[model samples]
Target: MTELTGYQHGLVLGKFYPPHAGHHHLVRTAKERCARLTVLVCAASVESVPLADRVRWMREVHPDVTVVGAVDDVPMDLGDPDIWDAHMAVFRSAVPERVDAVFSSEAYGAELGRRFGAASECVDPGRTAYPVSATAVRKDPVGCWEFLSPPVRAALTRRVVVVGAESTGTTTLARALAEHYRRRGGIWASTGCVPEYGREFSEEKLAELRRARPWAHWSEVTFGTDDFPLIAQRQNELEERAARLGSPVLFCDTDSFATTVWHERYLGGRNPRVEEIADRVDHQLWLLTDHTGVPFEDDGLRDGEELRPWMTDRFRAELTRTGRRFLTMSGPPATRLAAAVEAVDDLLGRGWDFAPPLPERR
Candidate 1:
């Protein structure tokens, strides 16, 4: 379904799991700039949400672009980088053939576009090879907001990540917060309140992560909103419209807590040097999900079932001690947000120094 565009054609590939503001940023920018936007949604991703939900997320952000559902049916085997080779072999039989431009989030994606004989350009907001990964997002989505923009964060109603060790109510909190936001009429992007990443990709990198990294393979995969590239995508979307829209506040769901956990568990210990570079963000917004009565389940990644109490203690002690602007989500999501917002109100409340909340991108 590639026709009726002002230019000639365009192609974009992504899992678009509960697509966030960053996804919309890139797509809307590409759509307006290109002739036609051909979107390929990874049909076989391991997300709990349906393909329709993924598509629906895209629609929520950008209604104009044409989103194509996965056409080729393949096995769910992820430990196969050779899959790209095999899938590429299927080539025309697998996805699409004709396109003038291809947009992607990875360097490899651009390389694949070149193989498809299309003009390839990477769409990451950060030009750096290290991007905010989907894996990071799945680990702890809300805490990762430091990596996202305000609009993007707003769109990530599903991205309220509650991170910590065993019994911290990470899953329960994620779900509860997600529900709270939805009741308030916002889109919540998340890994279904559990920790998983790269649910949709070439299966090659995913497989490699599963094998070689095993304990930390999923650490590298950040969501579309977790890094500079995602934010840059947001900027360009507006830049194309007006050139300078200032910096957008993107909300990240997780951060070093995710990486730190992986490193400590598998790699022996955390590094001060890496922490220096990784400890980047404006606030922590920590929530001690571990209360006495909360129940936790071992959702593949986490093994904390008697959720709450212990995990909460650790997260609060370490993260809070970091000397950052962190406020624990004390009660329910609504109550926590209210307290946080009110705290902001106290700080910026009646100050003539404050500016109104920025107008959203058109």
Candidate 2:
């Protein structure tokens, strides 16, 4: 209340489901009042924000304050009296040292303080000082962008992936759109592409295998069947890293779904790992390149010219079966680029500049 001072060690506990400005205010208030401040980020398995990501945000925002990431599997129904002990156990594990004060804007602060033998203080208990909450942020993260950190915004930013069969200009179209967004100038003025990590991996493996065993064909070896999962894994990792770089939008050359399509066609079945990663990588839009009359240029790695149409059919069938949103682009590079640009622009136009209305109280 009155400047919140005179405490040696202060503690603050929160879900930080997706940290908003109000949480920032509470932590900063505690940090100013105490000699040492500990902000525990307690996350459940079902929470939208992962425990590691929340810890990263807290540490980045308040580098001086000690931040603890606690994982609690116990159910989170406040009405259930059984949850308190589970919560207390998690708190004790994180904040082991004796605390002098506990600061929070919720009534639970008093009870939490009692468990630590610390005095309790409420800061902005009525939510008048800062009008944001984690619930409001989660319901409409892009709309509540102003209150979120860069890492959180990066996580929320939608990635549009351009994918298709081999020799269908996936890289060309992806790079073109990325450059177009870069030149358009806005929050998306510096867009980046998650280049096909699979292609890179394939080229490397091709050279390595050829050098090691001249008689061995890549198609006959484990490289054909076993390498896709690793490629998909690396591709996902690169996409996440690109997102963390803070570009408002990412134009991915290809996605793990495309890799699964290739796996189904080449390896005779599906790689379960690739399928699992495909489910997790959320591409806002899929721009499937049409194989209509686009002459297949022999790029050292492609022996699938005859299989081009078949692969295209495979991609179309899978997209339809999975119920994914996609637009097929055919014609010359210019025509395809124009169509892709229009679709992406429509997505941007619809999603841009949204300010979520204040959430209704439960």
Off by over 4 Å in 2: 1-6, 13-17, 20-29, 32-36, 40-147, 210-224, 350-362
- Poorest 10 consecutive residues of model 2 by lDDT? 353-362
lDDT of 2: 0.80
User: Residue by residue across 1-362, what tens digits does model 1's lDDT show?
Assistant: 34454446777776654354456556765686576676777644434445675665565456677776653334422345565565555445535657777777654666677767877766765634334555455454444444543333443332123455554444455555444433533222221222222211214444666686676544464332223333323322332222111111112334444434433433455555435434532232444443544445444444334434544565566666675444565665466556544443343232222122212222
TM-score of candidate 1 against the unseen true structure: 0.37
lDDT of 2 by residue, 106-156 (tens): 877887788788899899987787777876765655456667776776677
Q: Give residue 87's lDDT in candidate 2 (0 to 100).
A: 74
Error in Å for residue 18 of model 1: 4.3
Clashes of each: 40, 0
Model 1 regions lying over 4 Å from their true place: 1-7, 71-82, 89-97, 125-132, 144-362
- In terms of TM-score, the best-performing candidate is 2
TM-score of each: 0.37, 0.70
